[model samples]
Target: MSNTAAVRIDDTPAPAFSAAPMKIVVVGHVDHGKSTLVGRILNETGALPEGKVEYLREVCDKRGMPFEWAFVMDALQAERDQGITIDTAQIRFATQFRPYVIIDAPGHKEFLKNMITGAASAEAAVLVIDADEGVQEQSRRHGYLLHLLGLRQIAVAVNKMDLVNYDQTRFEVVKAEIVAYLNSIGVEPTYVIPVAARGGVNISENSAETAWYKGPSVLGALDLFEQARPATDLALRFPVQDVYKFDQRRIIAGRIESGRLKVGDTLVFAPTGKSARVASIESWGVQSLSAVSAGAGQSVGITLDEQIFIERGQVASLAEAAPAVSHTLKARLFWLGRNALKVGSRYKLKLATAEYAVEVIAIERVIDVEDLANHPGAEVGRNAVAEVVFRSRTPIAHDSFLDNPRLGRFVVVEDYDIVGGGVIAEAGGIHQAHKSANITEVAHKVDFETRALANGHRGGVVWLTGLSGAGKSTIAMEVERQLFLKGWQVMVLDGDNVRHGLCSDLGFSPEDRAENIRRVGEVAHLFAQAGMLVITAFISPYRADRDRVRTIHPDVFHEIHVAAELDECEKRDPKGLYKKARAGQIPEFTGISAPYEAPEAPELALVTTGKPADESVAELVRYLEANFSLTARNQTESWGF
Candidate 1:
């Protein structure tokens, strides 16, 4: 939002003209003439270079393509090589009403994630639906998403009218269908224009093809309307993307959301509760005399009046209405990860400029994003709209997506992968999401030293891997009770027991089993975060999957092999699941239909042939005490459990 590099998109400083350029993006389904519409606009307005259109035509002839409209977004080599609009692209055009900076986005399902980079910053959206195609899936979806993203002003350009014989009736049919869907999704397009972008009808100039319809042209509708920004003009909020400091002067770089900032004004930092005064505002080496007041669309760097500790994540806000900061968060999630979102999917939650480890606590309910009706018992999966509860490893200052988008939206990343993106509807919930690296009381702040005293030496996951009726849970619980008696702060996450509460509705598919282990791993990690030794007993049969669980907790996880042969485990038949599996009652019964992969490397292996729980508990205690200590708090109220 910096004007020094690019002129402001909308607002003008004086009455003569608006300095903020009118930037808009046109997005919809493929083959709907989005790029052609842009090309037509540029051609009619003379925005493109004299030879650019001819070059495109020549390129299309060489490639033997019929000059599809989507080719116009080939600003980068990667885009042309991929033969798809891999990212949101921008181009400029002018109408009698206003000049526009248009962003053309991809419509393919595979590239919807890429669409976000374009739509996230736009003031309004123009959905191009094919007049013949009516409201396609992406059309309805884009409309719904536009509503969700809080883009208020909308205008629909029903293109391809020429294909429908330029019939106003055909245009009306598509218009009604789209209007119905948009209204159902809580969006009312200000105007719907029937035009053929390729034929040059009703683009920048009026078209005579649709004489039956007396509506405005595409450019007419846009020119007639004015830009409407987010309401309330809330306090100035900007998320620091990066911090640059040299020669003892600090500069924080970010985009402004609303309101303004001036020099010598008091500012507060989020989640950290720190405050400082702005000494100066500088951008492009120009020092703003009024640094305390910076309007929206302005990106400025400010120097503190007093020397203060700052970080990339910390939010600078007005002294009033401090941003919420807490580890526990409850919000609606739109799961877009390659795998279904379930309990124990731990990843980094990137809120504002800060990223922290996060876990899915409870899936309140999964709803179909398209239908809006709640799916009473839906488990996590791709493209699901669920009201899920999650917690972050540390407190982050953020506002609700409904209230302030400047600091409300966030994306979750797993290592280098962007798995999920969500809005913070609310934060600082009933449970605390704080954690410590170690197990016992200690003098140090690092997790290693505190863990040295908590569990006795070092902490790790005791993964009990076996088939059903292998007595993993029974032994795990018994050992936990003995450790509790010996003054060990131990937590037991039983695989089946957890399902009865946290994961009651999940089924027993291969994917479901992996989700179960993942959830258990995350819960055990929380217990470890609380400075307690956690014992996890599940039939986590897959060695690679079990290894995946260990990676989640790192040094705090230990994979324990509960070696009970299939024949011996079936004889025990404690749960009768084995008998049912053999009788064809269950499809995914381990030791019958499903295969259980044993661990190649186990920190502790207990042969499950009637080994007394007491002996197993003693052996676990000795091993854990030899390596890790039970960690404890060094000071009162250290935010460590």
Candidate 2:
């Protein structure tokens, strides 16, 4: 973190004023007076222009209809005629505490998607309920949604109290039922007030009708609603949305999803492990500045001290608080798709600025929205919630929703439509979770030592990495042939050979390349554990990805960098890749358009630019012989093989 941006949230004092308006949403069951509550707030706060209410009354009289305060929020003619809100309508108003943007969401089952769009962005929520109708289906559904959206601060408005004779017993009965239901789903409302939106009781001020009630007014409760922890004070998490080149300088643009960033702060982009220092803060049509700190939802662009190849879908966070990197995640999903969320089905998951192909590997349990009952199911139906395990096609950078909502929540897109939304519950513990649940894992009866003794050699993998046309494949093949002749169990895993089948669906993007290397590493590890020496040849451009492979097979993995100049590799381009890359026919071609991060310290470094192929093979063989002996006599006796 930069010195200017570093500030502990606990040490900061609360501000008396806010530059940004508070965003809150009003939601509940249909015909529960949600729109009326919003309209009453607007009318009392003078948010509506003068004569607007009279104009609506005139229109209602001409049509021979009774005037309704809900008409103020139901702007669409269809909504007014049908007496239902079909979409979320945003109404801006000011309270005594601060300005607020109130979002009125639809309650119809057919329009749950619209409700999600509104609630997902709101910081707090106000759930409306009809005192006479009590708790309805939409009431329970919307309450669960508030929890899923990570909105902890909530207030309840029991409207239509006038219809129930403004009875204190009626209000308490409805409040108790709702409170119990909400508590079952882990939501506690800050305040539950009795109000008749049409009669204006307890909305702006206390009503004589509810003398038994002793809570703050609706407006007062809005002021009591605690503001969320400022993003400037949390850990820095800026997801890169785009990289722009304006004349000579490059600008990285994104909203500071959390925490603050200043000029000269060292930032690391995850899922790629690329780091850069902020050179200057950019603001359009404004005076230039050396440093800038943007809170949540504030978009800003900054130039880096060094131009690095980074694009959308990468999170830029402080190096000290780097995000989690994982290929699988456990999430609680709210399914709204037309089709059921079936296990093993694939969907595109979009979170913040990152997107990946994700699959539902396991459906843990489904919870009924109406009753909050957990039921076992293989698929989650529309308008249902479930806990599921999702495996991404590649690694993703994320945090738990409890830790950071901006980077934790994601939406599932099927056929280009957002069909589902979810919040990450856990990251990087798929295998560990499986083990903790008493699930038995199938194991191989033949141990590694016994297999190695039978093969007369130790199991291992020699990973060869370098730029394209660097003689990696040739050296690997030669080494494999020599080892086979020496009566050792040896095999060669070429990148192109495996791509023909195992990785046919993958491409050359940074994410795809990382997945490709991961798959290859897994295969090589399996071979090594089976008591066979595996040799892998690949460009493996990113050092972080190569490092991940080493972590996968710590004991058996050996990284050998086949050193060769870029010019030499280009000249020796056997597959015409360099020619294609120079002609702009291929993008992200390593050593040309894309980057190639060389290993800082490899097990063996062989210069293949001018040296003969035979000499390079001889050097590789010498190192392998010294490290991995063909004879396992000493280990055979120890293991009693």
Candidate 3:
């Protein structure tokens, strides 16, 4: 192994001071000596109570079993009998540098759920591997789980060095294997040290048994880890728990999950678009103060300047940097339900203080934890990690996990039981439009109502979505022509035409397709506002993408599904693209390789299979006249053509 200068152990320490305790989770495979290592650390650091170790030795002696270091942490009777930890145990200890909370997580496969629960709150980790056995399957799984939980600071301890006779070559081999795997998953372990936990070699002091090894001991490696960033440094996320009315003041009560709040600060409640200013900070037991400021993790009550209808489940943040308001979001979740998690399954999502009814819209991919390979799967089995997309009927406020972990993580509840948990990878559905601080929106002189009256018709968007060869463009063009001949302003935004100019820079990737649809939707909305019928024909495959467009203007946006079977559309092959896709010339072609999620319920469904294009166009024209033509509704006589 490539060695660094030894971290000398100080025999005497200075007086300890107050500091936040850093949480660290110790994990490994079964029989890898994780608990033993934790026990040794506790004993060597003088963290154990005066008589705790003697008490444990007496209990073991009476039980007719030799005293083992693992017995120090395996406190339960079942754990002692089975020689395995079944539950997570947390113990606090203080070193000269700082106080630490060491969470001993179970290594048994059956207790992985409990391990996850324990590691979720940890900021750093210690992964234990057996020196004799090197790395095992469970070791890799635990390492991946640590990465999944977002624990970046890690230390790998090759325990039981005595079993391998303190072999330097063996330790180097194990270190190389684990280091390569961890690096593949974006984890650079802070240190990889070889130690014998049962013998207390390198637990706190250097031992002559492994004199060739020159690195910090496990405790020293831990003390070197930087503390996690304070929550107050992150964006503001105050979830309102309740509101109390005390005499004349209406006090909003909640805990600040991140950032800081003070008197006179303006707050905006999400999903409601309501704003209020903090009039006064209220405390129950304390005397009235001149100025009071609450930061992350503090619970406080405050009265607002204006009395707006505010309730629980609403998040408060600064107006300039608020959480995303969306009905759709992508998540990387680990499913723990008895039944498989499939698309279309309904569950309640608990995010921070808010609860929303969400349905799984898509299962992007199932990740194989052992090898880190992604495979397309229809459902996620128990303990499987998968990337999923969820949609709610109403908008929910949240942030990406990278932005604010407090507001970004959520749990999936079914029948009042938490079946899964995940982090929000991306927020979508309806994005809050933002402009530059110095820029302003110019108002139009001619409004939609005035333009509609002059044109004798109402303007709207007619979005046609379906398979590639479903004749959406053909029917859209004919409908536009018929409407124009009847003295109404109409235009067609065909997929190919838009790609030639407006969306020319984009490609056919899923993300690119969603962006293409978004740009077209915005343009269509602008046309509708200008009193002109805008017809868009595109193979917008994702349901969430279509829903985003409908959310732009539900009153005027009409979705027409040009229904056609995939086989029939492939046979038609109007543009000869299907042949190219089948021959491997094109990649991610919808209806062949990529997925195409048809609309569950559209405004209209026109079956164009075996039907003439002209007939479909005529039917579309009649539907528009009845729904959008204002003159047609009032006239008693028809105009002669």
Candidate 4:
């Protein structure tokens, strides 16, 4: 029992102090006395309040049934009649060394789902086996699950030794067999004790019936299990659970899974890459606390200095130490479905607060739960384990299980039920974070200045911007023809020509238009890098969209705005687009009923309403030659800020 006395309060309140708090799960085969062992622990530790056990015993007697220790956990009438544990039950208790929340996991085949849910939250486990029953199927299966669930701290309790006449040989034989199975799954028990939970022998103290055993008692071995690594020492990971908007402030709330978060700290939400600064740390009842920093499993609410569109399923991490971004991952999963998990089958992967559509790409190997041996298989059978690869339809922020368990685990849902679970072994895909990192660096195999000087002109993008039918395309084509005639390398990327091929799949929505402009900017940047002058003509209406294009080629991006009144452009409807737009045949037609955000600043603006196409082209050429050196030189000069 703990040094602190158990206080009985009318309305139960949390304990003042109880050492380190830990979650321990008890699992084994059905009828293996798992609940009996739990009941014995609660009784021996003095955790049960006065009259509680007597009350239960009286109830059992009134029902004309034998009062078993399992009755303490199997409180439901169905469980008592069925004589099986159907769900996980939790009880709070404490030993001399620490406080515990012991979860009793169900052992029936049909209730393995409940077992998994209970085991996943456990930090340590106890595997129970009946001495007379020896090793059962669930003995091996539950042991394997403890390994798969990443529970390294475990102990084995050989219960009902009194039923075997307290024979040492019988206990050793059962322990050896079970130990071999656990070893196969790469788990080593902290202690293996021979005990009779019903008889209350070898539980809190060594029993004379087991004089041959020299190990610590059950209570002693439990105290030896170490606590999990401290989350405050690891990288910060806070998964947003909800966004609450109270009055003028928006608060992001969640549990801090790892590390500490402080006010004024900059945070980046993963997958979306949105950034924010912590404005205040909020606690429910604390009025004077200015800062909040919590370790693993502590709930926190924070308001940001600047509001950004963020929601649940986005992991908040440090900007420099963000999680991996990918849609493809290799994982090791345990299949618990009644139906086999097959290749090409679609399922829902629930990780943290996110749910994604996933498909099994490959079943690398199926593990024999009984022997822990690998074998080739086309699918993962019911209650089987396998190393599989899955492909998500969209990218998710994650870390390898070995690196961060909080962000690495996921459960698979089939037909609206959780049927499988896994942990990421590796993050790999086309849009990997490593590949994205490489994009930020300037790749200079052939120097940019050298290529420009050899081409006799500085490579740059000539972005011609105006409404349709404003002579922008005509002037762009004429300039391209004139440049080619001057023995200069030039290319024209007309918006219509690009839409026919490069952007054939895009539509005319606002989102699609932004994407179209982004693609054009990328293509133009590549052409300029190759020491060629690229001219682009489009009705790029949004100022933010144009600014995004400018950042792509900041050194040489020139915006030539072609000015024409709406009346003039409508009168010169070259492609009859205005007529169709006015006829209501087009939706989101820029500058016609739809909004058009014109540029606030332009490098050059030309009045093309009454000007000839040749005159506009000449002015463009003069501007380009006066600002850029078109003659070949041995050295190149940097231009623009």
Candidate 5:
């Protein structure tokens, strides 16, 4: 049905081109003629093999169905039977300008994951829209996704114009709607043209059906788009893959992801601040070379001048352009997990060659793709986009997504299955005492046994975590008084009192709250190390933040959950916070606007809903005395007295 002739399939090798093939992904709503358009392009460019179209036509006849251009690309039997593309298919074709690899991605919502996988690597995109149907939800979603994936070279093809009788007014209406939506999402489409893909009208040449329209055809628009520049011009980023030993030399092997590397360049391994110079470049089945230079996309092995301990997952870069080293980062994530992505859940963050155990600390906001609206939420549902914050136990090296995409992109894995993908928007600086590189920990001269013998008890931290109005400070004060009266060294670090001095500069934002907890946990650990019972009462809502404190001193950290129902806490309203939060006076108030992640397992749980304060204090005191008291058991064996 196309005006152009289709070429026959050949067995001889095809002619080689000077440049690498440009990859383009075709996407849109289902039943919008994405496959049909791709098939038309193949035929118009004479890229289809001989008898291929006839063979598919015969097959359609046998099945008692009209032959369709979509069948040219939808080669799978299941896809032909179902009349839908379930997976992505790649095909090679050439025009007068250059060769191209067109990726026909599924347009169905259920196959969006496959579409993302295909489009993530594409340099350009052709978004197909049904002219008769105007703009649909999936059409807008696909446009937003292309923008999110950083594809700017886009061409919108208004297909199925024959159904609308090739009316110029109808095509203009569809084009305007799509253009406005794409522009709102910061995507400026290079071209928007009307074409009837079924009969190949206006695919390779301008059609007379739309005499008023004067835009280029689909193939012409593609030729006008520019190719992406090579990444070799960017800063060097070489993530170490492995280290091998050959006789007396140790060879470091990895592919240069960006920029260039040469012999004698001083490279710094990130997060460790270790530097080494490249001495020689190594190659297999080739003669030894000394001053070899390598650019991006080349895998090379090099020997360091001075052998320092280096391992896989360490990124090598110049000191001036080294990646950020931090324990916390902000990301724009697309979650695909069956379970909702919530705060405090743990996942393995795989970025470049490094993998870190990361926990979600906050979900800033979830974005609705249909309306492009942002809503504050506690969790991200399946196939939703959200801005989230993640914290790792140790520092990890990475670049911002805009600075270098290779090191910025990451995937979240839960239980050995990839559940989410994202890009690092921001990397937070070191805020924890343990993360500080300049500080050195000093050891105490007096041993634990000496301090315990003098104080009559061992050092430990009693951390009470709960929602507001949970009687945490009330019970902590009472326990402190009782322990002090019994001639034991005890101190209570009430949240409000500490915030007046130590955390005076912090606000109530999620980042500031996490930092406040880190400071408090460090101070509590110090007090406990001095053989004192340090009691901390605070509304530590995030389980990940509390779990981080436990890791500081696992043996001495005692997490006590002050269990209180939300309604009861609201009814009590100790500080009038619940009332203000209800009145919309306070923002991000826990148990009202924000979230509270209860501890899955704690050292103790006290139900303070209706119980007397004295009873709760008595129970807590008994727990402490039984666990921290040196005289409760054999002191000689327990403390090595």
Candidate 6:
């Protein structure tokens, strides 16, 4: 737990960096020799750690298979049975210079998610493109994912030269195609090696074949090439990990992404765009030095000159040009989504350790790798390349994935699951606040305890919604008054009440409706966060829109719909508005002039058409108590802002 709210402490062990081990992630399609190439390197270099070879040979022997090179890396039963790499296996090697840890990732369509996991943290990538099959869809996607993960530094291994009889034309053809795709994805390989892993050609040492190609061998690139800078080192960046308080002073701890962060140096937070001065630099559970300076790869804690509130996902910088912050942005996505990247779809975006719900407003275009141009994608209800525009629910400081990659990438999710992964090409300049969003000190004087005490119990959002006149607002007010008088910090976000004040300028269009619901949901979320029981009474009317709201909470979104019969609603005449709505007084009235999508399933149901307001309020309060903590906490989610 953090002393301050927002930051989350991860339990991953400190990286084993006493020796500054270099990591290379091997990625390519199935049967493209990713495992074979790794096996060949381990064998030729005698870098098979301990009993890897003998154990793999025995496993192969017992399994009644030939001692193929692939067996050395394919450790999982599913991979061995399928004769393919299923999961990434970490194998260490030394090349008489730097110790190398080989990351072997799968190449099949079914296992692309594993590929992402393997490459997400790699310093560099070894993209294997088959000489015979050339560049396949998976190859393109892997390249895209590498770029998204901010690992642009790459080397290509043109494998299976033996199958092409070591033909120079074949290698050149595949190399040309691979190069084109790489450039499209904004990566140019440091070098391309023509190798036959099965035949030990151009792997560790040069083979008798491929003498026609003068490029360095696969081992040569790993041994002798220079690597591009790590993303965290390209810019002066520090992602907030945790904020600790001791002796009434707060210390912020995190890794330095780039340049240098030192004690007493002035720093700015990106996305939030706030500035502060470092008071001290501490390490190893002790203060290292007063105003100490450090470079990339060091985890240090710093005390600010004063209490300038900061939280997780905020980037600290030492440069004049702070990173970009925005409300919404456009992203070019490589869809690994189980569901297609469709227009108007909602998803959860996880960047670093923070996640948010975002909607894909439009699919602008899809890249045709072969054509080398982007067209409106064939969302064809499957994962494909698409240029998507999204509107976020809150302001987020964003960087172009190509610029400062550590903060530029995102994942798309549906419900609570990850559906796609992507890199940001552009942070919507439109969303960048020309004026700052200051954190006002006067909003509420109530602390967490005060709000909790006032609420009679812990306060949260009981987001009741449905079609217009579904009795959402009416029941919500009655519920709010009941909770309020019972010593609860209760508030109702009625649709009309909001439209007249906080959302006065907003109109009733689908886009405006989405924005309206999104804005209200964010406010309610904040209210709940402050430990207040917020009753939101709005006719969200669409399942997707309601779903979008449900995906926001750090916990669960407790949705209770005020489901009422249409004829009964028309007959009640509580406000005499339903009759006027049906008589053409309203253009898009729910249950009459506009569409109303009833909740298919709700945590609690209420029939408000004929029910008394006081009675309905009593029922709502009981429902809130029972389902106050329920949220659509899908592990997979996306945030638009």
Best by TM-score: 3
**C-alpha-based local distance difference test score of model 5:** 0.84
lDDT of 6 at 37: 89
Q: Given candidate 3, what's the lDDT at residue 134?
A: 81
In model 2, where is the ten-residue run with the lowest total lDDT? Answer: 1-10
lDDT, candidate 4, 531-583, per-residue tens = 78888998877664676678665788888898898889999999999999999
Give the whole-model CA lDDT for all candidates, comma-separated: 0.69, 0.84, 0.85, 0.81, 0.84, 0.71
Candidate 2 Cα lDDT to native: 0.84
lDDT of 6 by residue, 235-306 (tens): 677878889887877988888766677777778765544577888887655554444787776777888887
- Model 1 per-residue lDDT at 520: 80
Give the higher-TM-score candidate: 1 or 4: 4
Shift of residue 581 alpha carbon in model 6, Å: 22
Using alpha carbons, what is the TM-score of model 3?
0.73
- Give the 10-residue window scoring lowest on summed lDDT in candidate 5: 5-14
For model 4, the superposed segments whose C-alpha errors exceed 4 Å read 1-18, 242-251, 274-276, 282-295, 301-309, 371-373, 426-641
Best by lDDT: 3
Cα error, residue 109 of model 1, in Å, equals: 0.8
Candidate 2, residue 344: CA error in Å? 0.6
Candidate 3 regions off by >4 Å?
1-18, 44-51, 161-186, 205-214, 235-434, 565-571, 579-586, 592-601, 633-641
TM-score of each: 0.59, 0.69, 0.73, 0.67, 0.66, 0.61
Report lDDT (Cα) of residue 488, candidate 5: 92
Clashes of 6: 28
Evaluated at residue 556, the lDDT of candidate 5 is 85
lDDT of 2 by residue, 25-110 (tens): 99999999999888989999999989999999999999999999999999999999899999899979976557788999999989
